[model samples]
Target chain A: MKETKKILLNSRPEGRPGDSNFKFETEQVSEPKEGEVLLKTEYVSVDPYLRGRMSDAKSYIPPFEVGKPISSLMVAEVLESKSDKLQKGDHVVGMLDWKERQVASAEELRKVDEDKAPLSAYLGILGMTGLTAYLGLTEIGKPKKGETMVVSGAAGAVGSTVGQIGKILGLKVIGIAGTDEKVEMIKNEFGFDEGINYNTTDNMTEAINKACPDGIDVYFDNVGGEISEAILFNINKFSRTVVCGAISVYNETSLPKSISVQPFLIKKSSMMQGFVISDYSDRHSEGVQQLAKWLQEGKLTYTETVREGFENIPQAFLDLFDGKNKGKMVVKV
Target chain B: MKETKKILLNSRPEGRPGDSNFKFETEQVSEPKEGEVLLKTEYVSVDPYLRGRMSDAKSYIPPFEVGKPISSLMVAEVLESKSDKLQKGDHVVGMLDWKERQVASAEELRKVDEDKAPLSAYLGILGMTGLTAYLGLTEIGKPKKGETMVVSGAAGAVGSTVGQIGKILGLKVIGIAGTDEKVEMIKNEFGFDEGINYNTTDNMTEAINKACPDGIDVYFDNVGGEISEAILFNINKFSRTVVCGAISVYNETSLPKSISVQPFLIKKSSMMQGFVISDYSDRHSEGVQQLAKWLQEGKLTYTETVREGFENIPQAFLDLFDGKNKGKMVVKV
Candidate 1:
């Protein structure tokens, strides 16, 4: 038997989660059953959506039960396999228990070839996050060449990938982030045409208009509320807005005050669509393959802000809401 | 020469338009020039969108100039014609000057065949207002059979048409109206599955839920603001919201306080689209032909709140904001 250290949800959080919300435990992992495989976690992804799952609320997916192992997207290596599809030493990515080791059925894990790109790429640019950005952009935000695309939280995993893909499609990409460094990284590293640090900007509408004088043709919204209202005012006629996340209003105790945008929407004849990555589960492989191809071609790049140890998982997850993570927040347990 | 009475915008209103904002003037009709025709206005359509055009602020259409004739969709007779496409006494429908009698270019008018429908029907059921409802429902709302479709301002022109179409498409159509009379009209006359009187309802959300137990799949919003926000909460996954109009917010001094629906949008993986009739200009003929066919088959019906005299045009237009119009408000000039 091998020892497995895991982080469990200690209690339901009302607002922002804290260290007290999680507890670490060690368990003995038994040998794999008929179709099961033992996985040694290489990297665990901590995303903004995990915060939603921590609370018992009606959402796209079910909530995490108190005292259960925190589940997340994990890139792992097969320690032992009893299935023909997966063998020992094979790298995989799947929804896995937040632990140093986990036992899951082989059907739950997708085998990954590390020879194409770095192993961590599966958790960032070529994983669910990347697929989300791709599907949201192509499926909803049908951006045209020379059109302007605006993305909020553009330094993070999904937003960063969306902006880069917009650039690849020959669109002028403008990004909004919380810090100057993230803005700079988006412009210099991710090839964004322009970036705005929402922290310093007094008027987001003016900043957006300044960055996108031709008017925003596609708005990839990650941070909703005031920023989204500002973008709505500047969008061109027949523009498409893709709502991937609303991190800004997630922690509010009461419903946030929103500016009435229906009038503007009517005038512009625009559309705003919201979607979860799972909505495109059937086409996820197509997205993954395209993103992987982009990654191998060096056309797309990703960054990870890895937190060390299973003990730091809660902190790493919390850092996402505070905009402390420069890229994808992941834990190395 | 024939006498022609016209109403012109005397000045731009600061807020809600009053009688003083318009001026009536009489002018002499001149002979038709080459490719021009003399027209006698029969029925003039009064809509809520005209209020937006009166202001200098940029909108979907150009602003109505001060001291100029307010253009509207009107059914008229060709008093004299210089173009071969039309002849004297031919009935026509076009964007014409709000005058009892005037000269219009042949290029601006389309001959209306009264054999298919009444000449006044060109300004209501088979006109821009009808097309607005038709395209907004089919293209934007995308209501599926057996889905619940909720439409606000249910007894008004666009809303009434939307509700009727919803029923024809095998949807359980629920309507929200201001008065009990209008509510009954929607349920009995328009064939809506149910109706909610927003004025009497203590909790609009509760009323909406009770009416649409299956949850709203399509929300045809004509009155935006709090009501629209409430509907957003009850929408099912992959629902579609068509923002046809926001009459409630049109005359506000400043932006109204709205509830944040972004979280719900993300949770439901839904879509909200705003459209102007002009956006479907390329498909105008398609919409008109289909609507005319429906009218002839008696599958669709329309009501006109006809306010007699050219002098009442301004008041008829303002009555739209007051929810006084039972269906399409038209002026007999």
Candidate 2:
């Protein structure tokens, strides 16, 4: 038996999640069974979407059960393998529990190349985040060349990748970020055509109008609320809005209200669609190949805000709400 | 010379439009020039969407220019024709100025067979109203057979037709209307599977949940306020909501606030699309052919609340906001 640390959901969060919501416990982990592999958790991805699972509300994915161990995408090393598919010391990624060591079925995890890209990239640009940005942009947004595209939460993992892909697709990519530094980073590093600091800007509608003189044809929305409402005013005819994530209102205890989107959508003959990454699982290989090609050409780049140690996982997740991470927030153990 | 009575948009209304916003005047109508035809207005179609054009707000169609004659779909008799395309006394239909008698280009109007259906039918079921219902539901709603479809403003022209179409397409149709009589009418007259009188219901969400026990797979929205907000909660995964109209908020002077749709949309992985009839102009003939076939096969029927006299057109248009009309509201000139 191996001693391992695992985090449990002590209680569901009312609004903003804190340390009280999580309880770290020491446990004895057993060896891998017949078709199982023993995994040592290396990198844990902490995202805003986890907040939805923390609540008991109905959602695309079921809410995390209270008093049970919390789970998310984790990159791990196969320390012991009872399956032929995975060898010892193989690095793998999958939806794994928040534990230092655990045994999982071979089918539950896919091996990743250690030399090809960083292990955490599998949780981000090379995995769910990358596929989400590409598929949502191409399939839903349906962006055309020379069309103006606006991205909300532009400095974050998905937003930055979406903007970069928009640039690659020959769209005039404009990004909206919370900070001036993030705004500059998206424009300068991510190759965005322009950026708006939503925090510093007065009258976002006016700012968006000035930034996109021809109006927005595609909007990849991550931060929905007032920013999304302002973007609605500047949408052109037949615009497509990809509703990716709403980090802004994810933690609201009560029902959040905003200007009705129905009127704006009607006026412009526009469409807004929301999707989870799993919806496009059938086309994952296609997405992975294209993303891998872009990465090889140095056309696609990514950033990571890695937090050290397994004990800090809960705090890393809480930081996502505060916008403390520059890019993908990952806890390395 | 013909003495034509024309209604001019005197001024834009702030909220609810009244007689003060329209000015009636008598004018001399000139003879049709070389490619033009002189038309005598026979039937005038007054619709809720006209309210959008009455205000100087940005919409799919431009706001009617103030101090100019407002126009809509009209069926008229060809009084005199200078072009080979039309003959005298031939009934024609087109978007024409709100004038009793006027001259228009022969190309502007299409000859309609008066013997096949009532002249007024061209302005309702055989015209824009029917096409709006067909295209909006099929193209945007994308309803799957055996799916549950809930329609708001279910007693109005588009809503009534949408519910009927949903039934024809093999969907379980539920309708929401203001009055209990309308709720009964949609179920008994329009052949909807279920009905909910939103005005009588204490909690629309619970009522909708009970009505659409399987959850709403398709929502054809015409009202788009509290009713729509209630519908949002009961949407099934991958649901499609066609935002055909938002008559409830059409007359609002200020921005209308409601529950933010982004969270619900994201949670369901659904889509909401808004479209005007003209967006599918290319598919109009297909829509008309199908509607005409259905009408002739005794599978389809329509209702029109006809108000007599040309001068009452403004009041007829105003009555739309009050839910005074059952289906299509038309005026005989």
DockQ (CA atoms), all models = 0.85, 0.91
Residue B308 of candidate 1: its Cα lDDT?
92
> What Cα-based lDDT does every candidate model obtain?
0.89, 0.93
Cα displacement (Å) at residue A108, model 2: 0.5
For A75-120, candidate 1 gives per-residue lDDT tens digits of: 9999899999999999999999888887899998999998987788
Classified by CAPRI criteria, candidate 1 counts as high
Local accuracy of candidate 2 as per-residue lDDT tens digits, B235-260 = 99999999988999988999999999
Query: Which residue pairs collide in model 1, if any?
Result: none
TM-score of every model versus the real structure = 0.97, 0.99
User: What's the true lDDT of residue B92 in model 1?
Assistant: 88
